[model samples]
Target: MSYKGPEPRRYPTAPWGAGDSATAVESGKLPAIRPIWDVHIRDTIVCLGGDGFYYMTGTTGDNCWAFNDGVELWRSRDLKTWGYLGLVWSIDRDGTWEKNWTARAGVPFRALWAPEIHFIGGNYYICHCISGVGIGVLRSTTQRPEGPYAHVLSDQPIKGGIDSTLFEDDDGKVYLSWGAGQRIREIKPDFSDFAGDWQDLAFDDSGIDPKAKKNGQPLRRVGFEGATFFKANGKYYAGACNKDEGRYSFWFASSDKLLGPYAGRHEGPPGGGGGNLFRDKAGRWWQTFFGNDDQMPFREKPGLIAVEFDAAGHVVASADQPFKPFA
Candidate 1:
């Protein structure tokens, strides 16, 4: 891997249209809502699909470590209001996807985590990640926001990579970026396997070591998970979440091509955390991230923020602004 260091991205930063959450509340709605209020969805992906609806899917369960429930998908038309669609498919149905599964306290669930859905080639492709098996691509042609997807990746190309995300370039070339030791792989045209070798997306010890500790707590390796990749302004951008030193924050890197020596992987605008970026009707960029709170003891709130490319060629987010339920 040729690491050429950071680039100059002079991106701008501002809020999307002033979304009125207060107006919705006064009109009799929730001030803030955590869709699946019970379990913890540490990471997920949400996007405004081609079908003109906002679709959200994430890892959820009956408890902390068990896959009691499979991945959940939610749909919202107005962004402010959301409703449960159903599981893209669950472990309850397919017990052979994962190995070494033992029953736990409650009803047993399959070991599924960090499932992401991407719409491409006029079809829905889900980048489903199981706990220990590998990442598989599920495809659906049903004309529904929530998909009745089928396992398309018989080869199961990527192994040991979690939080896998799909980014299709302007030329219809597809790339998969996954965390838990960040790596990128290009899918073949047939979608049966990866086209080439897996490329290292992040340096394991670029700046931080795995055993390093900060303020007494162990600091996470800089190669965080839940990476969302996209191409903008003729450059490849990869955004991920990480703990610089025992603290959670959003980070991103840019490259000149689909796979390259990443440049300037760093945190987001001040006070922002992990978020998934999406474009709006006006072609403006906005991100939806969770409030920095432990869902176990407190409520986890999700909100939207605007992002722009700075003049230095860096992506800057409007972190200082408050999250609005609607946009």
Candidate 2:
């Protein structure tokens, strides 16, 4: 049978197998490939905190494709054990314009999609999108991840795009890109508003994906959604998601400049799409994972896959990958 929507949220009586033990993870006895927590989450994003912890947030709620609450977060010291931070931001209490409901295909849909938490300029900020509406950013007043958060762009969204992501360059300049890297703009140093107008980004080479077509022609963009940006090894990388042979794939393209005429896109990690990439406290590269396709080992649960740059600076699955996807 074909898939419908996400499985209805069911509260577990007791915690299920929460991956390997913390000792195993710390001692390097196990590879970090399993779901960190058993919960229904999509577009999982993890960022290293100033206090030496990893904070994770994603598209969360009972029915995210329809309606639900605001952003929920989880904290981890070792990446093996996660502590729930509860609903840090709520649409009902904290949202100003974000509380407005928007309809999707004749259905009233209002849920936070892909809320990314980042520690930038000595403070914590979250950029999120509301389906059918647009994207908005929030800042932690107390400089904490579990924020008593407030909207940076008051009473309106920053832009009309989904899967909004923030990338902080080495010089501490922050850029916001969304909708699979279709548009990007620089955010002000104070997180007030866009410092510059949106620039369109595209790849030089068109990727082959049978499912991604526009007016009977193949789409040339990286992927249809889930834009991620990061600078690695002195090169800027823009990543997004696409379906290849029924499996969700993370595709990336690189360029010397931020606003790219990026090189041709290539697949990064198979079955690892709709997520972002980040380095841990130890400076090791990793990609956030929440399986979105049947080829994955599991579905709709947060997972992590170790990644490394190849000789050509392409992100690929690391040699220590534990939970390999099905062939």
Scored by TM-score, the top model is 2
TM-score per candidate, chains pooled: 0.71, 0.85
C-alpha RMSD between model 2 and the true structure = 6.8
- What are the lDDT figures for the candidates, one per model? 0.57, 0.77
Q: Give per-residue lDDT, candidate 2, residue 112.
A: 80
Clashes, model 1: 14
lDDT of 2 by residue, 1-327 (tens): 111224433322222223322332343422335676888888889999999999998987656776668899999998888999999998877887777766566555577898999999878999898887898889999999988998885558876779888889988888888887877888889977779888887566545444445665744568889988988899989889987656677888899988777875777776568888888878888888876754555567888888999987888778786444334
Best-fitting candidate, scored by lDDT: 2
Cα deviation in Å at residue 167, candidate 2? 0.9
